[model samples]
Target: MSEPTPDAPSGPPFAVPITVRGYETDTQGHLNQSVYLQYAEHARWSLLKAAGIGQQDLVGHGVGPVALETTIRYLKELRAGDETVMSCRFRWGTGKTFRIEQTLTTADGTVAAEVAAVGGLLDLTERRLIKDPGGFLRELAADPGLLDR
Candidate 1:
């Protein structure tokens, strides 16, 4: 990734707007359970994009992100045609892992779901967790501040 431009977005809680699609719904007409995770994943990638980090950037560095665990709380039903926003935020600690918190909210401000995940950067060659995932991400990000809380 290159350096952040003067107009790059700043800080955390990166958001991506979405519209629930008919194909993403279950027989019950609510969003599929697994799709919530997909939405969260999309938001995370969008955040990376916003920070000017691309898959090649991480791959070239021999580093890739992995999700160790994820938990989701379904708060409300999301049907097809519902406009929503998926937001992502990263919370880093002292080690190789970090916490990813995300929320799926409807346009009317209803929170449809919340997702929390444990993630880390993997060293492709070694197939081991990177010693400092946050540091590695910061190095890859054009707007490092976007990773900050």
Candidate 2:
């Protein structure tokens, strides 16, 4: 198994901007913690697009990976008017899963949140875990070479 590397990325990591609407906040005047997870989801999809992987392709191939688990570490609180740049890197697991390690950062440079997700390859037609598509798995495995350790 290729180890999960600790990478300090050059740019925003998976830096994407988000506008915090009033409703997304709690009485504390900061973005509700739950909202940060939502932001990470968007960034994950964007990474797939960047990787030329799409939901359609997974379903059409009769295979899919579901977000079976996640871990989120909150570093700093964010409020309205703050823009966040989040970066995500795809991880291919030796076990039965794939993972994404994501970091959300403030515009200037501060970790707002960290998200780690575990998803497993599924035989969607049978609704069970299965070996991933070899070609696609290779692509994800190849991704870490692009990371900065």
Candidate 3:
């Protein structure tokens, strides 16, 4: 797995750098479309890790994140050996659900794609969306400010 690298200190959105791999490319020599989602997912997890929250932490809390909807806007194409940066930003409103915005940009500052998703914390046992997801995240996050919109 790739390590998380912060592009800025004390920010609303957290970013991680990713280097495209040969195996991740499509037959057309471009990054696979599905891999974009994986990149965004990695960024989200890395953000949680940076906030001192881990998968176990969420599981211990009886909650896990679930994506309700996702939309991707593709711009430039990425190929193997390309170095890109993926960013994750959480937008918390007053509810059990939240919105996450992410962007993938090549090393030359070209925007490869943009991803927007609606997600929520799920109660593992109850198998439903948990109430006060943001509050729960804030309670678990070492730096609650990082979750602020």
Tell me the TM-score of model 2: 0.77
Which whole-number lDDT from 0 to 100 does residue 98 have in model 2? Answer: 64
Per-residue lDDT over 1-149 for candidate 1, one digit per residue giving the tens place of the 0 to 100 score: 23333233346477899999999999999999999999999999988888889999999999889999999999999999999999988887777788888899999889999999999999999999988777778877898777764
Whichever of 1 and 3 has more TM-score, that candidate is 1
Better by TM-score, candidate 3 or 2: 3
> Best candidate per TM-score, number?
1
Better of 1 and 2 by TM-score: 1
Give the lDDT of residue 83 in candidate 1. 99
Question: Please, what are the lDDT tens digits per residue for candidate 3 over residues 39-79?
Answer: 99999999898888999999998989999999999999899
Pairs of colliding residues, candidate 3 = none
What TM value does model 1 have? 0.91
Better candidate number, 1 or 2, judged by lDDT: 1
Candidates' C-alpha lDDT: 0.86, 0.69, 0.86
Question: For candidate 1, which ten residues in a row score worst on lDDT?
Answer: 1-10
TM-score to true structure, per model? 0.91, 0.77, 0.90
Candidate 3 residue spans exceeding 4 A from truth = 1-12
> What is the Å distance of residue 139 in model 2 from its true position?
6.0
